[model samples]
Target: MSLTRLLFTAAASVAVLAAVPAGAHADTGPYRMPPPPFGSPDAPGADRLTVSVVDSGNGNDGTYELECGPAGGSHPDPRAACGRLDELAAAGQDPFAPVPAGTYCTMQYGGSATAHVTGTWHGRSVDASYKLTDGCEISRWNRLTPVLPATAP
Candidate 1:
């Protein structure tokens, strides 16, 4: 395979691996993977977010209210979504982080689905947009899974 193809494959592999359950350890090498989270994080005041799918092929086109730290709201599955977010946070990964600069993305198209997420997370304000325009974007969307919807490649 060409160097470029190999790099793309590696990046894609990374993306796939990133979709692993949040409770999975991020460490590499000899570190042993631990069991899934058995305890819930203490519920604080209210960390809320609103997810609006501007365009969707599935029934998820409407808006949803998500409340974490206690995991209650209009979101389809607040517990799972909040658990996913908790896992990401514990792994030191920002679920809403943007695609890094200059990162090459595959030309593969995921879909025309568009989403806008707004509210406060981790005590910080958040307003992010999501689109399944390319490979990286799709992976990012999938990373949030049911929080968004596993409707992409």
Candidate 2:
């Protein structure tokens, strides 16, 4: 091609490249934009929970994704689970609060089941685990029943 034409093309290409956003070349995997912060005014679908239960002895184990604020997910009963969570939040208590100090707990062994719950509730993060080892722990585990798979009696 002519020298002038080549020079014009090269300059135009450089200008176009400089106009592009720096993030345009970033490789942030699937999500191009960072996920919205939970409870942020601009965040949608931020109130959600992922729950998992494991009971090797009883063969009762499953994982469920539960959403609140509108109460939707693969959970068996989103409404009930959300209601329970709302109750806990309304009372300003953590659903997975440790056995209170000086509280009496029976010495009976409950069972061999473990559960994990992680998600956002009331815009706050929740990463809790439950095990049925003692009376108090059993009760805590029971409170999240249905959200976490219920152990066979």
Would you estimate the TM-scores of all the predictions?
Answer: 0.68, 0.62
Candidate 1 similarity to native, TM-score: 0.68
Question: Looking at model 2, which ten-residue stretch has the lowest summed lDDT?
Answer: 36-45
The digit string of per-residue lDDT tens for model 1 on 51-115 reads 98856677677899999878999998999998888888788688898899999999998888988
Off by over 4 Å in 1: 1-45
lDDT of each residue in 1-153, candidate 2, tens digit only: 999999999999999999997668757456567654433445443678988877735555678899987889988789998887767656656675667899888887877788888887765678898887888887887776656666766
lDDT of each: 0.80, 0.75
Clashing residue pairs found in predicted model 1 = none
User: Over 4 Å off in model 2, which ranges?
Assistant: 1-45, 56-60, 100-104
User: What does candidate 1 score in Cα RMSD to the true structure?
Assistant: 20.5
Give the C-alpha lDDT of model 2.
0.75
Least lDDT summed over 10 consecutive residues: which range in candidate 1? 36-45
